[model samples]
Target: MIASSNWKRNFFTIWTGQAFSQFSSSVLQFAIVWYLTDKTGSAMVLSVAMMMGFLPQGILGLFVGVFIDRYSRKRIMMISDSFIAVASFIMVIAGWMGILSTEVILVVLLLRSIGSAFHNPCLQAVTPQIVPSDQLTRCSGYSQAVESVSQILSPAVAAVLYRSWSLSGIVFLDVIGAFIAVFTLGITVIPELHQDENRGKVQVLREAKEGFQILRSNKGMLGLVLIGSLYTLALMPTSALFPLMSMSYFNGTSMNASIVEVVFSVGLLFGSLLLARWGGTKNRVYTIIGSFLLMSFSLFVSGVLPPSGFYVFVICSWLMGVSGPFYWGAYTPLLQSNFEAKYLGRVLSLASSIRLLSGPIGLAASGVLAEKYGVEKWFLIAGGLVLVAAFLCIMISTVRNCDNR
Candidate 1:
């Protein structure tokens, strides 16, 4: 275990390295999406590319947790980072050869997604081992802030680099970033979970099943997970249609859309910093419930706005972004606090899988509903659903007292 005195040093070192990796990856992703759009204007291709990126995580999340718990999480993280680096290198090669077809790009995206399937969970599982339990929410907030910074900067950076540099050149940054992550991880001391000598004899599927049982046995956690899933389901459509809402309903320009995006990211950064400072309410559930109400209110107001109310819509978007960290910042730590360290990998992965799967379902519905009815109408629907979900969470006593347990 990391010593209390060294915890901040260890955690920040690792976090700084991961921040670099995340920024580079975000730039690479932006490049890939732009390349695909330029090559094929079809939304189908874009959707398919997105699915390729998410499918592995959604499907393999059920199983990867077992390996994460049984083996060296540190090794898993290094290997996953290395794997992603190699994938980016392959993209670099393909880009230079003038053979970076859509198929090749999609395949590389799949490979990166597979690597993330391992790396993300391992990182989550490793956090509680290094940081004090009481500080998990603060750490989560800081982490979110780092991600928000990347989100805010990446698009503009990618746009400039894509114009001035070759795609391969931009992708090579990911290689460097990954190397830094692996090296920093190499130096950091992450305590490993104690494993039974007979653990190797256990079937992977059985272990995965055991993880599910653990979650199932906890009625409150399960309800929280379900509520989170439903929230994602309602929120995804609005998220997916943000650009459309800005341009179509508000009759705004591309610049207006970009402004909305930037403001939202700024809000995320602000909220994350706020959460880090406050550590949220004594009961994190109250923070989450408050976030849900705030987001629901924002979305509902966004939908009802007239075209002339574009500025108000932008403010609403910012409010929605601000709500993000309070919900996730609290929710993740809530899980980390409640679950045993060994089982957390499985629990987090399963929850992640459910959340990931719900997104595409919502996206699929979004395009159709936004097409037939109107984009703004879906926001109203999404807002109403979230309000209902929040009410359910409040009524569920087990969830209310989940943190206490």
Candidate 2:
């Protein structure tokens, strides 16, 4: 019955738009990794691309948070899509002429990352505006489903295209997805974004400062932020290592790497489907804790499991995906529901800033670890650390008591 509701249609349109964009990027993302690996035979190159792609987005998040709150969220997203499309078009052209060196890839990643600085906030801000507070979990769950669907398909397609076509073809397809995103935004009439009434009176610095003030005043939110930040430190290593894991653990095979990634993505899709059907528990903090525990186990399991078998690696990879939605569904809305509407963007951005710092450290560290001790050892070490951190959080009565508020 809920599936036939009007809100479903609107949410579907937005998610569909985001799906295509993610699909294109996912494909392009893997393609870059694959291309770099083949050309340079270096894990560091992949690390650089992955870190640069995330670092800029993280760095600009604070400033962008203020801007997004001040401006139209929908327009910001539309413009971001346009910028991404143009940058992708440039990449396509450059690749066509055989100019896809490491430097070019780095520049492309940098440009797209800058565009994403705006895109991330716009997307998060729009969700609370469109979806009722009661349905936020379902809304987020459905979005993750579509996103996972894209993730499962996009990289596999890119892998095939890389073997058959050239980088130009892959880039062109990516541009198409980006443009489709723009078209979707163009057709959808955006709702008015909510802001605090007192927002007009506050200076920008004070407004930004308000996020910190809220964090300090609200013990629950503050604890959640610190807890989530530590959890991110655990998770980042896996994100950085997926590419290397494929090569090192799977006998240095490209196809094997793709399969591992797709399986993980499908696991994410399966998790989202479950969340959409049942929704998450109202005890959001408990739900989050449960997910983190599962993630810790999955991370641990992945390390010891034989990396050669397709099924075992897939299962391990899926475990990572399964933990994702519960964490995201609980975390994102916690901030939105708890904070003043005027300060949501700034708060979310601050969250973004904290989480993003985990990227470079994780990527660089994991890459180095993999090179020295092997990827399997790296997984075990990282997973063990996650378990310790999660255990610490659960034991802390302060963190355990944090709620949406």
Candidate 3:
């Protein structure tokens, strides 16, 4: 169990703050993407902006994780949130003045994401410090659930606000939301400080050198990171390609795009719920494999599995949702259960950085290929590759015995 004070000040407050920030960020993301696409109608611009936004997280994250471990997690989060708020404030003001260019917006998104890269490892590391090991899975599930709630609300809210209000209005709300998160965070204090031996070292290079040494020696942990990375890289195309596919093969309407998003959110929500209730107690490794296989199999349709009907699409969506909980419940709990606290931030960031870095490539390439051949073929190809990876993962003794630690 978490200490009462820690639970009140750290977990509850931090989670709530992050959730608020995430909600606003979600809307901000929608605004930016919507604005870029609506204004430019240039896929190339969207691709560039997105690449700038994500590139920093992938490139800078592991080192930032080292900083998070070396310094105070709470401080990291507070400062990063503050900076992002200011950045958003500037963007909103510039937008209102009719001076916000795509380049300006791209720069703003990249800066905000840099802040997120710092914020993520600190947040990941801080959780285990506040919550008990046994409760970690439930806590993670709850955290995901809260974020899912934000996600559920963000798009719908953005759509309404965009119609009733304006894109600048949406960004202004995001700025307010980020500031509110900072205000909430200001009230919370971490009970205990986690000290890193690397912190006292005179040279930053020395500490980084040692951090790398520690990371390189852990084979089991390395295996898990690789699994997460490879799986994410292989399977991420389907979701990234969803909008294009919906536009191409489905009803060819904005509603179809929204349906894909709504289905994804529903899947995420249900998956989070399953993780919350069960917490992945039995053969967690096997469950991950099963989850991956199911998702792959569901996507491995020839032309389209939805059979050209709304009901059929809904069923496919629901089944796709089924894969999420199995993977996440098992995956998250396993990592938090076994890894030592001091290394958690670095390891988590390392994995996250690598996993996310590949996304833009997939997103852009999928878009291009869909335009070239067709989305159905993209699905078949991406899905087939995912299934092959799943088969390999299940067959590998190291992957199968992942939970042995």
lDDT of 3 by residue, 129-238 (tens): 77776667777777778776777788988777777877677777777777777777678766445465655655545554555565556555466566666666655667
**Model 3 misplacement above 4 A:** 1-9, 194-196, 201-206, 302-311, 364-372
- Kindly give the stretch of ten consecutive residues in candidate 2 with the minimal lDDT sum: 1-10
Per-candidate Cα lDDT values, in order, are: 0.90, 0.76, 0.71
TM-score of 2: 0.88
Encode model 2's per-residue lDDT on 1-405: one tens digit a residue.
122355566666777888888888888887888888889998678767877888898888867777777777778898998898788778777766877678988888899999998898778877776667778877778888888887777766886899998777888878888888888877765666555554465476766676667667877677777777667776787776786777777675767776777777888988888888877887677778778778878877778877555467677788888888888877787777777656667778877887787666666677678888888877787777667666765787766666644
lDDT score, residue 194, model 1?
A: 86
Give residue 388's error in model 1 in angstroms: 1.6
Put the candidates in lDDT order, highest first. 1, 2, 3
lDDT tens string, model 1, 1-405? Answer: 578999999999899899999999999999989989998997888888889998899899998988888888899999999999999899788877888889998899999999999899889889989989889999999999999999999999999999998889988899999999999999898888886742647587888999899988888888998999889999877777888999999999989999999999999999999999999988888899999999999999998998899999989999999999999999998888788888988888888888888888888887888889999989998999889878978999999888852
lDDT of 2: 0.76
Off by over 4 Å in 2: 1-6, 95-100, 194-206, 243-256, 305-314
Clashing pairs in 3: none
TM-score of each: 0.98, 0.88, 0.90
Q: Which of 2 and 3 is the better model by lDDT? A: 2
